[model samples]
Target: MKMIVGKGSCGIAAGANKVSDSAEQYIKDNNLDIDVSVTGCIGMCYLEPIVDFIRDDGTKTTYVLVNAENIKEIIDSELKGETLTKYEMPEVDKQRLEKQTRIALRNCGVINPEHIEEYIAKGGYKAIEKCVTEMTPEEVIEEIKVSGLAGRGGAGFPTWFKWNAARSAQGTKKYTICNADEGDPGAFMDRAVLEGDPHAVLEGMLIGAYAMGSDEGVIYVRAEYPLAIVRLNIAIKQAEEKGFLGDNIFGSNFSFRIRIKAGAGAFVCGEETALIASLEGERGMPRLKPPFPANKGYWQKPSNINNVETYANVAWIILNGGKAFSAMGTPNSKGTKVFALTGKIKKGGLVEIPMGATVKDVIFDIGGGIKEDRAFKAVQMGGPSGGCIPADLVDTLIDYKTLAATGAIMGSGGMVVMDETTCMVDMARFFLDFTCKESCGKCIHCRLGTKRMLEILTRITDGEGKDGDIELLESLALNIKSSALCGLGQTAPNPVLTTIRYFRNEYEDHIYKKKCTAHQCKNLVSYTIDADKCKGCTLCARNCPVGAISGTVKNPHVIDTDKCIKCGKCLSSCNFGAVIVD
Candidate 1:
């Protein structure tokens, strides 16, 4: 029997390491003929610490939420050839797995990410071998073009177009870069890929380097992703040992090598120009395009840049043939896209779907709807740079053109689900605040305009907004979008713009009525004592940090509205349902 524990970052955080330790110790002590190993995340994060037991007959049993103690029990059951239904993976999770079209995540939860043998057994380096051995660079480029795979890193630029440009560029030297610097606020698709399936990403880069006739590759991953960095280092060393990364790989004249460049966690570096600038040891800021990376990138040599997800799709496309992938999504956008599900979501984790799938299917069917079964209000797609898609557009087909039409770009697939209690105005404010701080200050319009817009949003949320603030925000957003030097500043106001477009009433309520309908903005809400429900055990008064509640002992306490900070301490402390927020 073989026991594999999901030991990606999420799995480790959920105690997969402990489970693995216990399972290994148990197997050793009992002298069982079982091998224990680890794999990366499967995107089923909610059922983390997932343990997969493969019997000698090749049947597999998946156990969810396994810990040190329960894992021993599960191992004992496996030894006895008995099934433990209690720890079995739920049907809903199985359905979720069956629902995803998984291309990038194909080997994530299945293979040992650190083992080359396991990866090769699953057809790991075949794509690069096919590229270097079977097909010419031009043939490889044509195959990618036929597959119609665009850059999965938000811009949706043709992957083949970039490679061809780099391939055709008249330069003595060329380079290939994987933009693993995934800095989106709630996105982790890249991190998961890097951690769970490092070799796949490396293989993709190898093929890209070969296609572009480059001898060097670099993975510009975020330093915050220590696990990914560690794993990438390990994978590179492993590939080098196997003669896959060094000079003349697979007996072909093509020679390529990859090194890691850990980024300083700048969100702006997600942009290609900015990433290149950072790679050159400069400020992570964007420069004017037209040199366009392919023409002159990375020390002014021809370069091809694709994000982690984009490169991840390469091996699959090459092996399966481009037409096989192009057969999937819409005309403009082809193949499956991976998204990070977060914020007020029940089944919050990684989500992968074909281009034509609707938002409804992901958020409701796959995501298991909102947390606590709350009313789904809006989904903040694309992170701070993306927009807040309202519930009305839940059925919107999740294609590049379609999502763009909704005022949100499918930015590297960050789908933050929001519930009814989420204040749209505050949500916009929150995203704006992130952009304002993250602004590299390269462009005057973005630096000052976003700050100005943020100030107005702050005023609106604080119940201090005046007339024309809305108009002022819209005007600033337009100017910033038109004049900002980079994609970061250009799309900084997207959340604000989308909220104003779809939930203008919420803005008006905060500005005109001095009320937040969702009651999220503390400055616009106050706590009051409900006389009918107050038992007055002095708990409210004792808990009020600012002495906001005052009354005789055993009498119905009243809240001093002027003194209240809207902290809701009294509300939580009161045994009786006395404190009310309004």
Candidate 2:
């Protein structure tokens, strides 16, 4: 029998390493014959530090939240032929994985990423071998075209079109790049795949390089993902040792090579041109269109770029045939998409679901609804480039055209759920703040227009808003969207525009009534003590950092409103819930 522990970044953060070490020590001391191994995250990060037990009979059982303290008990229980229900993964979490289709993340949690043998055993590198030995470059591109696969980075442009463009472009040399510089706030889908299944991404890129007739490649990943970078480097070396990379693979004339370029975490580098600039050792910024990347990219050579998720689906599509993938989702958006489900959510982690699935299906059905049983308010789809989707539109289908109709893009798949406690006005301001700081200042409209909008939002949230502020914001957003140079600048106003479109009332309340409905803006909220509920235990007074509350023991406390910093310390410290926000 063998045990496999999850060592993904999430699992490591939750102390999986300690559990692995402890289990190894226990086995050494007891002279048990059990073998231990490691795998990547399984997407159930909420119950992390997971351990899977594989019996000799080939049956597998998973245990969640395993740690050093309980590893012995679990091992002992398993050895005695007894079941420990508490340690087992809950059925609800299992159902979360069951209700979805996993394509890009197929081998993520199942295989040992460091071992090429494991990946080869699971049909890795076969697609590229097929391309090199039997299929022609045109045949490979045709299969992708039939699959209806688009760029999964943000823009849903046809994958076949880009590959075809690079193949047909007039250039002596060409390049293939994977945009792994995922800078979205709540997105980690790329990171998880890189750490869990690096070979899958490499294999997909190999197929793309063959199809596009590019002999050189680069993966522009952010330096923040050290684990992903390390694993990717390891996978690349292993592939090279196995003759999958470098000159003339499978004894064919198709020679290709790939290298890693670590980015400085600039959000604009997510754009293809900006990424190319960074890869060339220049400042990360976007260039003009017309001479798009396919024509003159990376030292004026033809180049094709796709994000990690896009490349991950390539091998799958080639192996299974494109029609098999095209049959899954809506007409416009085919196959499945990977999402980094986060923010005010109960089962927050990675989620992979088919296209056309409703927002409610992901949040309520798969995500297990809002945290603390709070009322769902809105969800921020995509990232700063995307827009907010209100709860009223929970049933909206998650397709490129449909989400675009609701003022949101299917950007890089970041689903940030918001509860009733989240203020829509403030949320818009938050995204605007991120976009404003990330702007490359190449476009005057995006640089100054986003700044002007952010200032107005700040004033409104701080209770200093004036008349016509909403109109001024709308005008600036529209102007910036039209005049910006690159996609980063063009979509910078998404959050502000989307909030104004869906939740105008919240903005009006902040501007006209001088009130924040969600009680999130501290300037518009005041803390007060409830006499009937206050036990006067001095917990609130002692916990208040500013010493704003005053009272003797056993007496009702009084809050000095002028001195209170609006930090909500009293409400959290009080046992009887005496503090209230007004």
Candidate 3:
């Protein structure tokens, strides 16, 4: 009998390590004959620490939400060929699985990341072998061009065009870079791929090197992703030992070597120019690009850079051919995208869906809808730089063009769901706050413009907005979008602009009525005690940290507005629901 447990990031976060340890201890104590192993994320991150048991009869049973306590039960039941009725089986939908074309994440949770042979067993380096032996540099580039694979790192630049530019450049020593500096908040898709399947990325880079006529490659990963960096380092060493990375790799003249360069967790390093600067041991700032990276990049030589997920897809493209890879997604966007679905979502985790899948399908069917059955308000795609899409557009297909049309770019695939409790005005203000702090201050328009927009949004949320504040915000957003130096500044206004487009009523109510409809604006909310519901209890008065509630035993309570701190402690303390915030 064999048993496998998920040990991916989400799984670990859900206590998969504790479960595995306990299961092993239980097996030892019971003297059970079972093979226990660790795998990666199975994608259903909501029910993580998933355990799979293979019986002697060759039947496989998967158990979801397995924790440390459940290990004893699993050992007592599955290990002894007894079924546990407590754990329900997850239903598999072929449509959901078929919608995703897992080229980039093919081997993510399927193999042990630390073992080189497991990667080899899964046909890992076969693409590089074929590229080195059978295909010429021009043929490889042509194949990628025909495949219609675009960059997955925010901008949908054609991958083949980048390769051809670098290949045709007049440079003896070209460089290839994998931009693993995934700094987007609430985004862990790239980190999952790098940690769970490092070899796939390495293979993709090798193929990319062969296609672009590059000799050296660097993986610019952030230092914060310690697990991913460790796995990548192990994979690099394994590849070198197997003659896949060094000179005459796999018994061919093509030679490529890769090195890991740790980023200092700068969000701007995800940009190509900033990445190149950091790789060159300089400040991680975007430089002016007349001579793009393809023309004169990295130490002033032709270089090509792609995200971790993009590189992970290359080996699959080479193996499966262009048509097979192209058939899965929309005509223009020919691949499945991995997204870190989070925030207010019931089933928040890593989800891989086709390019044309509707946002509603993802949020409802896949994500199992919002947590606590809250009314869906909006979904924030992309990151802080992205926009909030209204619920009416939930049926919109999640393609690059469609998302772009809604003032949101298909950024590094970070989808955060929001519910009715969320105030759009406050949401916009929160994102502005993030962008204002993250602004590099490289350009005058972005530096001054973001600060001004944030100020206006703050004023609106605080019920201090004047008549023309909205107009001022719109004007500042336009100026920042138009005059900013890079993508960071250009897209920083997306949250403010999109919120105004979809939830203007909320903004108007705040400005005109001086009210926060969602009760999210702390300054606009007033704490009060209901005399009838008070029941003469001094609980509210006793629990009030600032002594705002005034009452005696067996007497009705009253709130002192001047002394109230608006912390809502009285609301929780009153058993009869006497205290309320309006």
Candidate 4:
């Protein structure tokens, strides 16, 4: 029997290392002939610290939420040829990975990432082999065009369109760049791919370099992802030694090499021009794009740039054939998309579903619905640069056109779920604050405009808003979208604009009534004691950080409104649910 422990960032954070160490010790202590190994996250983050037990018969059983304490019992049961049913993954979570069409994440969590042989066993670099040996560069571009794969980084630009442009561009020196600097909040799809299946991304980059006629490539990944960088550096070295990368790859006339450039985690650098500027050692800011990267980029040479997910799908399209991928999704958006499911979701992890699947299908069927069974309020799509999609539109199809119609683009695939207790006005404020701080100050419209919008949102949530504030926000949003220098500033007002479009009443309530309906904004919330439910436990008083709650023993507790600070500790501490917020 062989045991493998998940060691991705999520797994490590959830104590998978401790579980692995204990399992290893138990195996050594018992003198068992079982093999122990490690791998990356398989997108089931909620069931993390996962342990996979494989029998000699080739059957694999996954144990979820494993820790140091419970691993010995599992090891003992396995040695005795007994089934440990309690540690097995739930049927619902089992269905999670089984349900999605995994092209990019095909090798993720299934193979040992540190070893290139495991990746090669899964037919990893065959795409580049086929591209160099079987098909021509133009033929590869044609295949991508037939596949209908777009830029998965939010903008739905055709993959082949950019490749062909860069290939045909009038430049002696050309470059291929992978935009792995994913800055969207709550988004970790790229990080997972890098940490779990770095070779797949490298293989995709290899094929892209061959297709784009580039001799050099750069993966501009974020510095925040230490594991991803470490794994990537390892993958590159392995690929180099295997001849899948570096001079005369696969013994062909073609030669391509890739380098890693660590970014400082700037949000504005997500834009191609700004990324190009950063690559040139300038401040990460956007420049006017008449010579869009294809014609002139990266040190003023012709370059092609795509996000990690977009390139990760390349080898799959090459192997599976373009028509096979194009048949899966709706008319416009083809193939599958990966989303980092987060916030109030039950199965909060990485989800890859077909493009046409309804939001309800992802959130309910796959995600297992909201946490604590709370009433669904809205989903913040596309990060701060995206919009809030309300519960009424949960059935909206997960396509670029459909999501864009609701004022939210299918961004880098960060789906933040919100419950009924979430204050939409305050939520808008929070996102605006992100965009405001992240602004690069390159263009006056984006620099001053987003700051002004954030100030307005702050005032509204702070109970100091006026009647024309909504109109003022709308006007600013429209102008910024039109006049801003780049995509970041243009899309900065998405949270504010979409909230006004769908949930204007929430903003109005914050301004006109000075009452937070969800009781989320601390400035607008009032804590009170419910006489009927309070048992004078003094638990609330003891837990209060500000000493807000006080009362006699065996009597109902009272919350001092002035000293309350509007913290909800009292509400959670009371066993009878005596504390109330209004």
- Compared with the true structure, the alpha-carbon lDDT of candidate 2 equals 0.93
lDDT of each: 0.91, 0.93, 0.86, 0.90
**Candidate with better TM-score, 3 vs 4:** 4
Return the clash pairs for model 1, or none: none
**Per-prediction count of colliding residue pairs?**
0, 0, 0, 0
- lDDT (0-100) at residue 63 of candidate 1? 92
Best by lDDT: 2
Where does candidate 4 stray beyond 4 Å?
A: 542-550
TM-score of 1: 0.98
Among these predictions, the greatest TM-score belongs to 2
Where is model 2 more than 4 Å wrong at Cα? none
Give TM-scores for every candidate, taking all chains together and pairing residue i with residue i. Answer: 0.98, 0.98, 0.95, 0.98
Give a tens-digit lDDT track for model 1, residues 1-582. 889999889999999888888888888898989988889999988889899999988999999988899888888899888778899998879989999998999889988888888889999898899888899999999999999999888888999999999999997699899999888889999999999899999999999888889999999999999999998999999999999999989998999999999999799998988899999999988999887899988999898899999999999999999999999999898999998998898998998899999999999999999999989999988898889889998999989999999998888999999888899989988988999999999899989998999899998998999988988999999999999988988899899999999999998888899999888999999888888888779988988789888998878998878888888788788887777888
lDDT of 2 by residue, 541-575 (tens): 99999998999999999999999999998888889
lDDT per residue as tens, model 3, 23-86 = 8998898798999877767566777878888898998877888888977887688766887856
Name the lDDT of candidate 3: 0.86
Question: Candidate 1, which segments miss by more than 4 Å at Cα?
Answer: 28-33, 552-554
